[model samples]
Target: MNKKLFLLLLTVCAFQFSFAQKNLLTDFPKGYTPEEVGKRLAYRFLEGKHMLHGGKWISYPETFNWNGALQFAAKTNDKELVKLLQDRFEPLFSTEKALLPIKNHVDLNMFGSLPLTLYQITKEKRYYELGMPYADTQWEVPEQAKPAQKDWSKKGYSWQTRLWIDDMYMITIVQTQAFKVTRELKYLDRAAKEMVLYLDELQRPNGLFYHAPDVPFYWGRGNGWMAAGMTELLRCLPKDHQDRPRIMQGYQTMMKSLKNYQMPGGMWNQLIDEKDYWAETSGSAMFTYAFITGVKHGWLDAKEYAPAARKAWMALVSYINDKGDVTEVCVGTNKKNDKQYYYDRPRHVGDYHGQAPYLWCTSALLEKDTK
Candidate 1:
């Protein structure tokens, strides 16, 4: 072949390969870009006066939004956004200390994730001092723990282990945040071990999880918790980590199941396996987050998963109202055995449960984000 022709052919081949590799971040339409969507969501989160629905102390949904907003701020290097979020935490030092959650339950302890994120960005000692204890206490066995809880603790699990699907994200995020900042192996190890056990006990043969064993319903956000939890864990879990294989397997399995259920409009149903159920925003966003992270990290096949992720993102953006609140989010729910309990849950607009995961998906889509 002629030298010039050969060089041109190689250049064309390289270009084709580059296009073949899915870019989950860009190729978005106006108002749906990660930067725009993330800023809108972060500012909206900061502007809100209250995140706790009626609880005296801040709960997981609110903390989850705070943590995600902080990450978005840090990723975008939005100094103003970071400062605003940090200032919100100021009252916990004194005036609103009572509003701070206690270290007893997984949901409460997960509040540590927000301050720890602030610590990572600002290197502030106050945030570190307040946050580390919550992560640590999660592993510390309590005297009042039941026999089964005691057995879980004997094997180094938290006494708070209730085998609920929601517990995985609540348990995983705080520990993952600790590990990310402290470079501590114990936090990662504990989360990984707990994740593996959850996979064994709760993950059904179909790769979807029941809200709990007795519930036997694949509630979307319940599975969303497991999906997002595994994605967060795998992001930090080392390639050679002992539990990596099992965690990866569970993540992949759930993702495949999730992929099959993604609607043509890219939203997932409130009951993931029930096509007749309503399209849900929070769970849909959460699943999109997992898909985006998995594709970005090379844990999932990019060509197949990236489009699904992109479609979900675009579809989620359509759900956001003029006020930046995510629509059709299922209200905070507890596990009930009856399928009707899940089907009948009210969907709210702008609920923190719905708003939180959108920032997560946006952050995952940012090209420069290596975290």
Candidate 2:
């Protein structure tokens, strides 16, 4: 072909390829499959907050948001976003303790997830090394004092004095990742042991795990943490390990119970069982990530669970505004035991906690079935 004709064809092909790539907020037909729409909406929400926690040029960084950005970049191959997160947060590493001083479960738990991502991206042993102290802190919990025990008072730390399902992922997922990097049996052993402890202490008779066993309430986001944690653990754990089946059962139970709680709009309420509770986007997004990742990894039956995952995704997508901003995410909270506490919780737009799940949801959806 002549040079001009060849160049024209190449340009047309490039345009078509770009158009075919799926993102956080592309419009689709009405009544499209829930998974398809959910995936699209999730991606749209994620894209909107690409530079979260930073000013137009300068940004303050938090551990959790940076962790999510790492996952999003890995999945989507958005190198610029990854570098942006690393550059902003790398300084924070200097002051980081093996365990964070923050009292909140989610905030402190973030330490476990961040270092592995840094290690993965930078191939720096220091990141992995930094994670070891946190892993050591997490793994050091006495067997008798594991979160599954009904008595929180027996635990040494003030923060860990109770059984919260969210802690399983927050603590164990990172330990497992550390094990992968360090190849230490203790990390793996401790992660598996802690997971069993949480499951034993926290699993409800209804098959869903409770938000906090010590408290009377069950929150959707707490369960989402459990589900996501299990999915992440399963991804890293050995295929032939003895705990695999038990772990799978935990995931299956969560998937089964959560489906009935899904709202018609494709979201789960703050109080998952209480229809009166407002639909929560962060929990819904986390569930979508867990379920979709479960399906991708062959832990959950795709045919049965994918629809529910898709519905949650779609409902979450509706929260994204035109500016690529994700809205209606429930803000960070410490464990609250009362129904009123969860119900009364205020929702915010583009909070850091919400950003992680937004990216996770989008990346998971894009991986499975990109339009």
Candidate 3:
């Protein structure tokens, strides 16, 4: 072969080899295993102990980070890590009433799942014991409460009577966990009913659920929460339950629409509809986790969804920097009016928000059952 042609072929092969290594579905990269990635994130949480904001730390929406750490600990079986979680988390319990101070449905959902995770790891009833009252109260919210109105508080947040896809994760998944812990059929029943309500009320004509009905936004991460939440809820829900089919149908409908929005690079943008929307990493990671988990657990068809999951995983890995930090995560936002509102959101690299989903997606993708 001519020297020029030989060099060109070598370059092409090298590029393909490099790409394959970075692609999580095709091959596991040498430097960062799922466990290592998870540990690094856990370490960050440890270092930032007091600085971590949200339910487990401060009472912020992003406090959902604790759930991510708990997931990593359970999957990796790192007892010391689990102990650290218990230490940090136990203090957050409200001693006055002996109940978690979950003021809103969203916090109730995020922190509510933690006790169940603690129970899973330690099998200690105390972890889940405190959550009982709150779990019981959640069932009391009328199945048909008018959708929440969208009125931003002084802190640039809004609430509405209607369900948003985000609430599925923020609330329903935790409710499902509570059901699993207590084995109370009511918890599952209420979760299923609420999930169906969101599906019925918020799902757009295009098959994707709107981010918020009152706000009329359809952000990708918002939908990611719904997809992941449903997958988690389904894992614990009974197979023969009547509500199972409805939930599955909702997932299938959303997956169909998601397939169309996937970019050539694999990541979805903040605004999934606009071609110019820059691909986002956090939402992409969550979607990949939910889709891959669904396929593995038989909730979704592997042959059909795996390709999309793989593509999103590949794009997600590309966002990881040399230091093993995941980047380009879109910042948290309230409901918005137009595509530009989503597109203009700032992006950050190596944020804990992004790291959680990265760990989740990698773990889900690399699971032997999925392959």
Candidate 4:
């Protein structure tokens, strides 16, 4: 009688422990590891015919969406995913009308280098040739990133640049890609300096950069651009270069600040540090990608940061609908000094901005080192 009762008690205890573990696992999405969820999000977003903005078939930001999937494919050597991205990009080769000419602002075609990347993979000259004009334009510094002083090019440089944090990616991603194609030191240096100057102006004492020095909103997507851009640049920047440490310092600082603001649910607010602001997916995805990459490279303490980053990835996955659309992304925003403006900005599901960052987060999480 005593032996039978003891066995029954042990069985009940085991069942209780199993139930509690399931509850703890709720922080992540069910039936998917971080890698699986990210890949699912990428494939889902790709299934849509109009993943681009304004119903334009393809645009600069959408290229990042494709490029992120491509990077993921490249890292995992997922041949099927690689083919899918190439097929998606095939329509661009059909016509030249959507491709921005060099006369346009370089930022207008921020992902112009995607063709160059495609060329490398497919050995198709047309893709490479299409990117040449865009590559050449990187040498032309826009007035936006140029310092305001007439002597801006002279001996002592000041941080009085008109650059918004968004330019960090818009300018550098294009330049870094050009460097990859040309092996030109100038492109690499230009990308690095763009980051250093922007950090000088926009990085606050708390380690987070502002949306703009004038605006100071720390708008979620704006900071997403910065984190995503810097991470991209660091991947290509020369290790021995002078600007590497400075940029790393800024990146580390930004990560530190972002760590403090992440919500328990794994999202950052539309206004970052503001508690009342709505949590956003695009920014959280960007931060997760950056942080996980940082941990992979030893830039972040993996023990402390990885868990939080994994949580953020889970929260990000929760935003994806069955259709692969990311929800709660802030729509395009203009510079504003008012905090309320950021808080009240409209959010839309399946926007190109959201899709691009989600791909990036998925790709980053899938990297071998992140495991």
Candidate 5:
């Protein structure tokens, strides 16, 4: 063999071997299988304090993240996962006050969603009984605090009546879960009505929803809440229901807009339409879940959108560190019109916002892969 050709071949082999060593497929989390990745995330949550948005473990909103874990548990029927959920909530079962942080805040009623789900899975009366009042009181119109008609002034309604995009999930998921447990149509009706009302008020011509009617910023997680909330409701909502078509249209349209905004690396910007804003984990996971859901339901084209979901999932997992911490998550944000505010918001590793969506996306991927 010629000396020049032999040297060139030796150099190429050495470079290839170095590349393999750097990016060994095995080095990327041992289980890329959605179920395994999902379990790793859940175990991380269990090992840490459940605090995400606030310090309170048993409250209205933050518990929603826990509830996502519970949903994943129910989907998999894993005994260890189920035990983790039961152990977390079993202490709160001793007193209604312990279970409910605020007696009358409808937002707080969202905490009941998990209990109802637990009741369905475990047949425990305490879980069912605990959740019933919140489901019943979720929609009672409160007397205006000072007889002024502003949404913030109302007690039970808190931002519920204002059609904020965040309320899309905050209100609907609990109500829909109530319907699932009791087989009552009213719970479903109220959830559906509120979703349509919000979409009507806030959905922009581009198909993405504004953070709120007054706030024009297309915040990533706010739109995430809207997309995930609609997907949740449609899971149990009846096919022939009067509002189904409209809700379907809104979901598909928002998905189209979301597809447009996804960055080449598979994550979305903190302010979704802003090119220079940072790619965020929570929003990216949510979109991946929504895309997987759309493809499963026949609302999206599998050929075109599945690769997008796969890409987003790949990007999302890159945020998970060796200890299972999901990084690059924008912390709980309020609606701000300033683009700088959204971009400047703090990002945290293992923030509950990122953890919950990472679990959700993994669960969705697992279910899709099995089919």
Candidate 6:
């Protein structure tokens, strides 16, 4: 390591690591337990009507929240909850078929993840049959694809590759689910290659990501998407896979920045480096999920990161209201060069954007039997 760089990392690591010595993490005091919080949020999501884009198609945030709920339900063996989630999806095959998002854009295409989860739980052929197309069509250039989209496919990337930071998660999850079900390399391979390109193009010297090429600001949720996306992909990436090294490197690099940027209040801001901005729960939860998974998987030094992850979870719980909605969640945002644009993004409650990652953190904190 470079002398100055080693000194800088050491200083940051020492500051982040100071915390309680006993248990590291233990049973939650009350409602904060993964079983408690996870079920509450999952049920809260169930209580809502099907959320759609343009009130016509199931929205990506809803799909993302649904996937998190499914994973949590499976991990906790909540068969009753699973039935509710499946019952909700039944409409899509019939009365709500028109509401199923088409595989055109990255956001809409990720809706396939919901049925794929259903397939994993129910082993229904229709679920698998319904879900795989979204993953396949991402790389299968359509007649509607723009010339640049076609060019991307010709170069072995998704037609939907717009180099947006958010695409990291949208493209990764559905394909990861496909790989999980079919044990196929192509799906995972496509995601890995795409991730490396995004890392090369977007990741900055400080290990944070710019939202887009022209939009050079670091929006919290944008980085959240990348953090959780990389964690998800790297977990499933085989040890010897060609892209693992680079992906893992990117993940670790980003995590160090996350640790350094984390607020003393155990949260992160809407603009991560803008410490005075309001603490954003959605991004905070996403980073907590990543840190928890990293520590548990031995991808990070437990002593160095476990305390930070644990503190983040405790802080996150403080933001959840009695109704189970996490407060102060930065609503869905677009990239902009103006710093104030990020600072002024609306803070919403119970938005699936916020709800999804809380469930993911619940699942990560509770994971024991699975690796």
lDDT (tens digit, per residue) of candidate 1 on 228-327: 9999999998989999999999999999999999999999999998889999999999999998888877888777887899889999999999999999
lDDT string, candidate 6, 1-371, tens digits: 99999999998877665333214554568877888989989999999877788788999999989989999999999999999999988888998899999889998999888889899988999999999999999988889789999999999999999999999999999999999999999999999999999999999999999999998877888999999999999989999999999999999999999999999989998888887898999888999999988877879877788889888989999888988888998877866788888888888988999999999998988875233
Give residue 290's error in model 4 in angstroms: 0.5
Clashing pairs in 4: none
On TM-score, the stronger of 1 and 4 is 1
Show pairs that collide, candidate 1: none
lDDT (10s digit) by residue, model 4, range 1-371: 69989999999998886454333323345534645665765676577654443454355666677777677667667788878887877766666446433434444556567787777677778877877667555554456654443244342332222468877887777778878877888878877877888899888999887888789778888898899888988888778999999999999899988999999888999989889889988888889889878876767876568777777877887888877678998887878899888888999988767877777766665555522
**Across residues 1-371, which tens digit of lDDT does each residue of candidate 2 receive?**
99999999999997765444322223334634334433443344334433322122112124445566576666667676567666655655664232233323333544656777778777988777666665565534445554553243243222353467767767666677777777877666666666777888889877677677656676887887888778778777787877877887887887888877788888888888898878887788788888777766666655567666766667776776654456777766667567688888889876655656766665565565421
TM-score of 5: 0.85
- Candidate 3: stretches off by over 4 Å: 1-26, 49-63, 93-100, 141-161, 322-324, 366-371
Q: In candidate 1, how many Å is residue 11 off?
A: 8.2
Model 1 ranges with Cα > 4 A deviation = 1-17, 368-371
| Model 4 stretches astray by more than 4 angstroms | 1-30, 49-57, 99-103, 141-161
Give candidate 4's total backbone clashes: 0
Stretches > 4 Å off in candidate 6: 1-22, 369-371
Positional deviation of 188 in candidate 6, in angstroms?
0.8
Per-residue error for 6 in candidate 6, Å, reads 31
Question: What TM-score fits each model?
Answer: 0.95, 0.75, 0.79, 0.82, 0.85, 0.93
RMSD values for the candidates in order, in angstroms, are: 2.2, 10.1, 8.6, 7.4, 9.2, 6.0
Error in Å for residue 16 of model 3: 22
What is the Cα-based TM-score of model 3?
A: 0.79
Model with the higher TM-score, candidate 5 or 6: 6
Which wins on lDDT, candidate 3 or candidate 4?
4
